[model samples]
Target: MTARVGVVTFPGTLDDRDTQRAVRTAGLEAVPLWHRDKDLKQVDAVILPGGFSYGDYLRAGAISRFSPVMETVIAQAKAGMPVLGICNGFQVLTETHLLPGAMLRNNHLHFICRDQKLRVENAETAWTRSYEQGQEINIPLKNIDGRYVADERVLDELEAEGRVVFRYEELNPNGSLRDIAGISNAEGNVVGLMPHPEHAVEPLIGTGRTDGLGFFTSILKRLVSA
Candidate 1:
């Protein structure tokens, strides 16, 4: 069966369509899921595309955490469903407690937008298996509140468990804790990152680099083989 990947569209979401396109480009059916809908449409994997969900009011992704769809997503994710959160989506994952740490304002206190270099630190996650560990890739990152913060103990735990999936290389754009650009859960089914991988999937776009396509392809491979 062809894998059906769901791209969630929350209010104010700007990249759901791009995420869907990337999924289709990766040879998977792209299913559109709504924030008010409790059902997942039985997708094999879910992608929370980046945007100013809930207008980024009260904090980035703070209000959107209570959306009906997220309630189901949180449960399904805990049950080992594959979930990939990008940019503001990453903020939601942290707010929902699906991932560790919180996102704060960038150290520079400015919204930074650019093509960023990141090293694949742990390619064992469902969303990163297509990449080799230590492989470097360039992806676009645009956000204001993108700094990842966690207590010392939790940071150490993440390091010890090898859950740090992506690390900023060359220059840390937001001064995220330990230069962390992405991380995964212990089971490697849930992954969250601040970079906009969907934006980098098409070669004709921004940087003309398709390095981000691997994220969608990785999950398709996992779902089909399973």
Candidate 2:
């Protein structure tokens, strides 16, 4: 059976359609999941796409943490479901304590939009398996609050555990600590990143590079093999 991946749409979400297109391009079924709905529709994996959830009011993702859908997502994620959070979705993941660290405003205090270079520091996670360790990829990144911050000890622990999945290469746009662009949970089932991989999945879009297709393909491979 073809794997089904859920792309969630919160009230202020803006990338659900692009994410769904990416999933379909990777040969998976893209299931639209509503923030107000409790059911997951039996999706094999879940993706929280980039967007200003709840208009990023009260801080990005602070309010979306309490959404009803998150209850099921949190439970399923804890039970080993693969969950990928992008941009604003990453903010929500941190707020829900599914991932450590907080996203602060850009160091320059301005929204940035560009094709970003990132090194695949750890490719063993469910969402990054298609990449080779240390490989570099270019994906589009756009956001105002994109700086990732964490306590020193927590950062050390993540580094020690090989959970820093992606690191900014060459250019650190938001002054994220240690150039950290993304990280995965200890179990490797949950991943949250600032770049919008879905935007780079098609050759005709963005930089005309499909480097981000690996993320979608990675999850599809895992689901198929399981």
lDDT for each candidate structure = 0.94, 0.95
User: Model 1 over residues 81-190: C-alpha lDDT tens digits?
Assistant: 99999999999999999999999999999989899999999988999989999999999999999999999999999999999999999999998999999999999999
At residue 196, what lDDT does model 1 achieve? 85
Model 1 Cα displacement at 193 (Å)?
0.3
List runs of model 1 lying over 4 Å from the truth.
none
Clash pairs detected, candidate 2: none
Query: Tens digit of lDDT per residue, candidate 2, span 1-226?
Result: 8999999999999999999999999999999999999899999899998999999999999998899999999999999999999999999999999999999999999999999999999989999999999998999999999999999999999999999999999999999999999998989999999999999888888979999999999999999998
List TM-score per model, in order. 0.99, 0.99
Using lDDT as the measure, the top candidate is 2
Count of clashing pairs, candidate 1 = 0
TM-score between model 1 and native? 0.99
